[model samples]
Target: MELNYEGFYRFVRDELNVDLNAYKEKQLKRRIATVMKSSGALTLEDYSELIASDEVIRNKFLDYITINVTEFYRNKDIFTDFEFILRDYLNRQFKNIKIWSAACSIGAEPYSLAMILDKNNIKTNEKIIATDIDDNILKKAKDGVFKDFEIKNLDKKDLDKYFIEKENKYYIKDNIKGMVSFKKHDLVLDKYQKGFHAIICRNVIIYLKSETKDEIYKKFNESLVKGGILFTGATEAIYNPKEFGFKKISTFIYEKI
Candidate 1:
């Protein structure tokens, strides 16, 4: 039941609409193998066919590939820069502050933003809209519960202030939960929401083709309020900030101009 390469290519086009040719062969193969094993399928071919024909398997495949493995404050330095930008914007004193945590996995990124804003006393009618393509991860994010290890890297004082221990696991305080909206959004297929003061989409686009990245950035550009910020991963920003209607606000932050 090993996948026939030719048959796999056709399934890619018909089901996922992702041309395997665009992905690095070894990487794609490894991911398929991993999914096959996780799904208890005998072969990649069986897994692929199941995902192609079954709605449940299709969603499960998307969830698996979304690869929502993450923890709170995954990189502290990045959050340092993020805090600076958030404060500067807050200091400018807008009527409203709208932030998007695109591809937010298991609640960390948006919750991080929420914690920052709450701690800073950033005064405004402000909110963070967190979105991800996978419903499973979205549900997890909504739950706002994490293990102790997940928040270990967070600033100690901030951690104490924003989270509480309940039954030996960490849970985001009620304030943080009420400050953000969580939604299921497929950035590869869904329309971008507009007028965001900032978009944090770290490490989410590396798997996508350049054209898809560009298309998403174009949508992001339009969604911003002319001078809004865009945050990508340290290794994830490939498009020139200028051409994307953004100027480099920092090594990992972009400002729409």
Candidate 2:
């Protein structure tokens, strides 16, 4: 039989319980080819068998496809803008705010928010919800350990205040770590929690298809209350925000209508 993507897609769906079809076709195909070559599999069938038999290979495949690239306060200037909005607007509007850091990778984004909340003394009724589809990544996030580079963007004062440096690795303080809660969540397949004062979902939907992106945006709009904030990635801006019941409040920031 000729090597084809359809069969590989089916194998992934059945075995992994992940919907590969939600991602962009070209990107998904390229990732599959790279992983297959790395495993020394000449055919897709062989690769599928290898993944099924080896737990490590299965995890490796999942890790590669999930895209866990993240850093604390990624895009510092944009984060400053978010801080301004949170302090000047959201905090005043809602007495006890609720925030969701969707597709939170390695706890950086949510922890970043936690630090902001701590520094500025923002009151939240509940812990910030940080979620990702990959269980292994979620485990690492819960551990709250980071290398020098991961926390490089953070300033010295915040670093000293929020993290403990031991053996050259920074460990998040329990106080800040306690502010955010990590959970396993698949953005495409899972249900979104509602009544969020602000939802930060950045740098993720760019890898998905347009329809999938549209679906996620619609769901995000639904998930937020009126006038709630939707902070998206720099590259993932909604050109026609009105269609999604949002108005462009700032660069990569939207306010729900």
Candidate 3:
């Protein structure tokens, strides 16, 4: 039997509440096919049936589809630029700040922001809201435990300052962990929260379709307050900042005008 891509997409939408259309079809279909093959399903229909009946299979399917490759301070240079921008913005603006780490996988990005804040001595009452579509990843983020490789970007000083090494794993200190709150959020389907001083949504949008990416950018703009910054991944720079009511301040950083 032939694999019905449309049928599988519909099944995922109705069953999982994830819109496959938001992703580029070629890449998304290839990923879905790979998952189906790995699961030993002969066709999309078979795979769909298997996922529908098996909770574990469904969860795996969801995990496979969402791109979750992230690390603390993934791109060091961009983060350095972000620190300077954030400090300058904070000094010029309000003392208290609210930041949203959209599509934050495993809490690294938000926790990184928290560490930067702590290092700079920025006192804020609000906890950083870090959100992802995966609940399991969110749970891991809340746990604040990471492997040695995940902390590779940090220098010795930072490592000692922010993490407690126990056996083979590194645990983020309470001060950093206390700065963030993790929540499960679907960027494609859910409503975005508003009035954030900054929104760091990096790398995640590259997997999305152009239209969906534009919609998300517009929503990010709406979510930010005036003069608020939108920090994206190095490769995911906005071609037209004015279209989204954003002014390009630096590479991968935009301020809402």
Highest TM-score scorer = 2
Which parts of model 3 have CA positions greater than 4 angstroms off? Answer: 1-3
lDDT of the candidates, in the order given:
0.78, 0.92, 0.90
Residue-by-residue lDDT tens digits, candidate 3, 1-257? 65477777888889888889899988988898888888898888888889989988887888889887888899998899999988877546977889999999988899999999999888777899999998778888999999988888999999999999999899999989999989889999999999888999999999999999999999999999999999999889899999999999989999999
Quote the lDDT for 74 in model 3.
90
Best candidate (score: lDDT): 2
Order the candidate numbers by TM-score, best to worst.
2, 3, 1
How do the candidates rank by lDDT, highest first? 2, 3, 1
Q: What is candidate 2's lDDT per residue for 56-175, written digit by digit as tens?
A: 888989999998999999988898999999999998998999999999989999999999998889999999999999889999999999999999899999999999999999999999
Error of 1 at 188 (Å): 1.0
Better model by lDDT: candidate 1 vs candidate 3:
3
> Candidates' TM-scores?
0.86, 0.97, 0.96
| Candidate 3 TM-score, C-alpha based | 0.96
- Clashing pairs for model 3 are none
lDDT of 2: 0.92
**Between 1 and 3, whose TM-score is larger?**
3
Q: What is the Å distance of residue 99 in model 3 from its true position?
A: 0.1
User: Compared to the true structure, candidate 1 yields what TM-score?
Assistant: 0.86
